[model samples]
Target chain A: MIKTKKIHKEIETLITGAGTILISSHVDPDGDSLGSQLALRRYLVSLGKKVWIVNHGSIPSKYMFLPDIDRIVRIDNFKSEDRFDLAIILECPDPGRTGDVKHLIGANMPMINIDHHPDNSGYGKIAHLDSGASAVAEMLTEYFLEVGYKIDDPAATQLYTAIITDTGRFRFSSTTRKTMEVAGRLIELGADPRYISDNIYYSFSESTMRLIGKVFSKFELFDNGKICLMALDNDMMRLNDFNSADTEGMAEYTLFGRGVIVGGLLKEMGEGSTKISLRSRNSINVGEVAHRYGGGGHNNAAGFQIDLPLKAAQEKILKDLREIVNGTV
Target chain B: MIKTKKIHKEIETLITGAGTILISSHVDPDGDSLGSQLALRRYLVSLGKKVWIVNHGSIPSKYMFLPDIDRIVRIDNFKSEDRFDLAIILECPDPGRTGDVKHLIGANMPMINIDHHPDNSGYGKIAHLDSGASAVAEMLTEYFLEVGYKIDDPAATQLYTAIITDTGRFRFSSTTRKTMEVAGRLIELGADPRYISDNIYYSFSESTMRLIGKVFSKFELFDNGKICLMALDNDMMRLNDFNSADTEGMAEYTLFGRGVIVGGLLKEMGEGSTKISLRSRNSINVGEVAHRYGGGGHNNAAGFQIDLPLKAAQEKILKDLREIVNGTV
Candidate 1:
């Protein structure tokens, strides 16, 4: 968000003058995405630079711990007089994978992709990708450190949120030795992991609870405990004022189920786009299925949005999951 | 909870020779206290020795993630055959400070008091209390390091929990450079912060959720925004079937009240003995008040138990809180 004065100069030269920076992320902004946005925004503000954290849409409610989080502007309403100097899309890949803002595909903004996803297509003017990093939040810590910015407590807090949230509190395989070092440094800078993880990851709204109950009630398991599936249609979502992001951990929770090798989420995104998220425990490949849909990720996790009806998409996912789970694919 | 075999050998010899290690703490059995106990228990078991981790009565449920958590023998249930080679109390001070287990107090076991409180009574064989240490957890890390025992992943995990939880995820004043170093060393040795914090801290149950709802619904604000209180009665708790530990942050949540100086929790512990917990935000010192009830902790955060009916305990605590908030005592 805050491209430092020197980085700003490079961006300016890249723009041939003053220009805009587009900010967007995964469909539902979790702690990592929002934390990354807030960190950059605060840094940019501190440097007296104009910056707007435009979204594909809104972030989840639990991350209200990020200071001044309410100020995030939506991508649709960002009234920019000039083209984006360097569009910075984080957490998510490119326009095709940008969910609702996928409409922004080929919108003519010079793109800068900064992400930790290994499957990135290098679809940016200047890309900085490190799949090795636990969280893009962790990446920002190194970025700030490299930029030699005197990041204080608030920046540390926001950045720490990014790392902790994205790395699943460092539970994911993405958590490497460097991740621990960065996280340790952040804690020393006053990240307060307990407060963030406690107040954000663990707590949920009553509405979220009801939605969780509804989803769990409808859970469908298969493949002799290898694959688990949960689906929610548009009607179910609307009744609870649920957005795509509120269904964040639904699929993953099933991974904790006894002997479940893979867990999958099939959410009806309405208008034929059904987003499917898949996770594996001990290497039942889901990325292959995701790649077939023009998406790819890690061996343990992958996701793709399909332009198919809810039931049809659900059937397709279940079939694929069944085959993979049974080793018959 | 696994102590190094080397430290285990040393402690076994100490126990055999010294015949007692005074097991006491500041007040409550937080992550630090329990982690230390659990890890030490595994070590003692390896040494083929029986160790007793006597608490006030019960440890809060938030920390039940440890093995043998329920096995923590309360001093009140002490049988005639129950004296130890050495009684090593980790987190409490005097016997009266031991919640419901106060009934187990006598002048029998020689004590080895290891703590970080400024007001320790020196009621032990070897008082290794350092007020500057961030936590007794941090102190134990130094102690473990001093005894020349290598902290493997599992051993490091216990120490890591002790340091992080007590320091409020490294946000509190107790966190020091050494704390981060200790964490770094632990990470280097394979201690996974995410696994421990998430497993130990984030894993909440259905009963906990229902209890949280009852808490928010029955909350109260008082002392001209200088205090917030929530009292859950037997019926409210019974209806929810929530454990006592599930309600830790309730009192501290009120510290966010802008004008509030302190916050308190007078939680009902069965029929008698109200579990009183307190937190101070800006200026008020709650430890002074807790001391009146034979409890002692930091100036900012401390707690005590009120051995009376829940309503009587609440009335007495409110009176005391008013005196502190109004500064008229």
Candidate 2:
């Protein structure tokens, strides 16, 4: 608690001291990054400070419903003449994750690194990184509470979106008692959970829905149903007009089968290369498996690329996965 | 709040005064009904009370992981000689909803009707009905808190499951600040949210996954993409070895498309009959549509049956749905 208070004080000092603020997060901004950026921007703007939210990538269509979403400017659209008194880098492990936004930040510029990732490199002059937080938005909510700032409805909704998406709607292990409490408070502050969830989860393109169907239909189980794999080849993608970005979260579907311990999604990335994403349910560390295959991730979720055709990649990876499942079971 | 306190006192008195208790919920038990029963039974059992959880239907395979779920007896296995000092009917609007369990309760026996449904008929001797609550488990959590009872881990898990499933993981409009607060407290009491969600959502049978894929693949859009329909005929079911129960939540998939205002699922029920489930996103009342076809439900979700083949039913329902969409949009 004391540590949180100390960090909140440091962040408050930075915010109060700044006249013009710049906010950005990692490339391919997710709900957490976008939400955290918008939420903090809303607060800073409310304080009569000039706030600019510049990001490397355009916001995903699903998250376009977030309040003040139009205010987020892409790196291509950001004017080079723009400057800031302070920069707040959110949910980024390192400044490099901010892409071209880093180039805009001059050396010696005061930066506040706000993140929940444990490996955050502590790149800023002041940092408030809580590894235990479900999302950077959770940390921001704590900071707002500590500084006695009343979070308005729009900011509450944005923060709530960040928390829900990052924690997988509170089903992820990172979801703590504090996360739920923060979400509850957000709801009280006028964050409509149903509205936000409807927009984020229910709005799917027709092609995307068809792609999901095709992908799910091809799901294969091996090693006595302990290892499940869902492979999407170029043919399936072309037929459905699927974008690679739509493959997000599809890897988790592999673990939906009853006995599945290790699940994987193999995407044919063209040029005889296959990108594989793996998720594990139990003690089997998929990260080690990914590492052995020149990829890295957390124990439960990991990924690696194989320089083989989809069919050959499946055949080769299944042997190793089978051996692992056999050894574990 | 005062009403809640008064009912809490009444419930406490009834609970303390009873030595042997009987618990049951509506037929075709859901997570809310099952979770509420188990949580209540756990608390009562901890108090040294002899509790019998006799339900009209068997527990679903997905909920088998709930702690002490084996203790719940199907109405067929309920002992004829068993008696109860008090009967607690949960989530049931009327005595008839309990099926044969209603026959087991003596006419003079004290009963508690605990429910969150607005139309609960006030069947029992002492009823505690709060329509505002997300689930019966939410009401029970309030009761436990009001009575100063320490919710154990197992009960906390049960209650947490009840809240999540009923509130659609806190995404449903029924979810409130109190619901999330109670869920937070449950986590603090040792309920593992990830474990519960995994067991409830991610543990899909291979056959069910295939069925879902097939269903999604077959989804049809009409009326300028405002109406979506997914039909499952006998061939699809037989091919996938699909159970009718697996159709649960499949109707929601119809509304997943971006422009979809109304969605319907048509299932072949044999004997030249088809069952149609409908879900709506906006002001179009699906219940009214269902009522036109001799069925009933709420505004957003409803269902009805037709003495027609799946194809015929689809054509017939699509016309009406098209008119409804055209009229509204």
Which RMSD values do the candidates have, in order? 7.4, 2.7
- Give the per-residue lDDT of model 1 (tens digit) for A1-329: 35434553453355344344556776656677898878877765665556667676677666766887876876667666644455567777665666665545355667767788777777776667777778888777776786566778888888888886676655665766677678778877877755665565445554554555465556666866567777778887777777676576666655644456678888888678898888875456788889899766667677889999888998888888888877842
Interface RMSD for each of the candidates: 6.3, 1.0
Looking at every candidate separately, what fraction of the true A–B Cα contacts under 8 Å does it contain?
A: 0.09, 0.78
Candidate 1 chain B, which ten residues in sequence have the lowest lDDT sum? B18-27
Give the per-prediction TM-score of chain B. Answer: 0.78, 0.90
lDDT of 1 by residue, B1-329 (tens): 24434444454456556433234443457777877776666555545566666775467765655555665766566564555556666665554455655444456655556667776777666565677777776667665666555566666777777776777666555655566666667666676765665565444443443454455445566755566676778876777675666677556544533344567776888888788889875357888888787776677778877789788988888888888777842
Q: Candidate 2 at residue B261, lDDT?
A: 89
What DockQ, between 0 and 1, does each candidate earn? 0.13, 0.78
Model 2: CA > 4 A from native: A270-275, A282-299, A302-329, B282-284, B287-298, B302-309, B312-329
- Angstrom error of the Cα, residue B270, model 1: value is 4.9
